[model samples]
Target: MHELAIAQSIVALAEQQAQNRHAAAIEEVELEIGVLAGVDVKALDFAMKSSVKGTLMENARIVRHDIAGEGRCGDCANVFPVNRLFENCPACGSYAVNILKGKELRMKSIVMATIGLQP
Candidate 1:
């Protein structure tokens, strides 16, 4: 699946970050994935497990933050929940709407080994 590639890219990014900091390994990783990001969580989890094999993040604890879909109506400035890309405004009944959230797929934070340094 495409999740494998996503997982591999995640691992590579984390590994590269750790290496740049001269870390011995990665301790934890935090990710933010929105509900409307179109990612299969189960598949991504499995792919991540496989992708981290023998890598710096092999022992890293992964933390995910799930964001709900939110949008704002352009016509009436009404804020509402949106599950689809194109949604009509609940208040004004207009199709003009801007998504405020729920389309994110990003790595939030990465905790790395101190490697003989005090923090």
Candidate 2:
């Protein structure tokens, strides 16, 4: 699954960061996912469990932050939710809308624990 490959990449990135900071293990990996990113959280979680088997992020928790889609109306200069993307603006019924948010997937933060450090 693509999630497996994605998770592997995430682990690799986190491990690299941990090593750079001299951390022992990854504590958490925070992600921001827009509604239009089409990422399956459950599948990603399952993939992460498998991908981190023996990596520095073996116990890292994946924290996903869901983002909503927004559309800006060209006619009315208003912004509103456009979950379906095909629907017109709820405020002004304008078909000439541009996406202001959504279709984004990014890693937000990586929390790591240093070797022999407690807290």
Q: On a 0 to 100 scale, what is the lDDT of residue 95 in model 2?
A: 95
Task: Compare the candidates by TM-score and give the number of the best one.
Answer: 1
lDDT (Cα, tens digit) per residue for candidate 1, span 27-75? 9999998988888888999999999999999999999998889999988
lDDT of each: 0.93, 0.85
Model 1: what TM-score? 0.91
Per-model TM-score versus the true fold: 0.91, 0.83
> Residue 86: error of model 1 in Å?
2.3
Best by lDDT: 1
Clashing residue pairs in candidate 1, if any?
Answer: none
Which segments of candidate 1 are over 4 A away from where they belong?
117-119
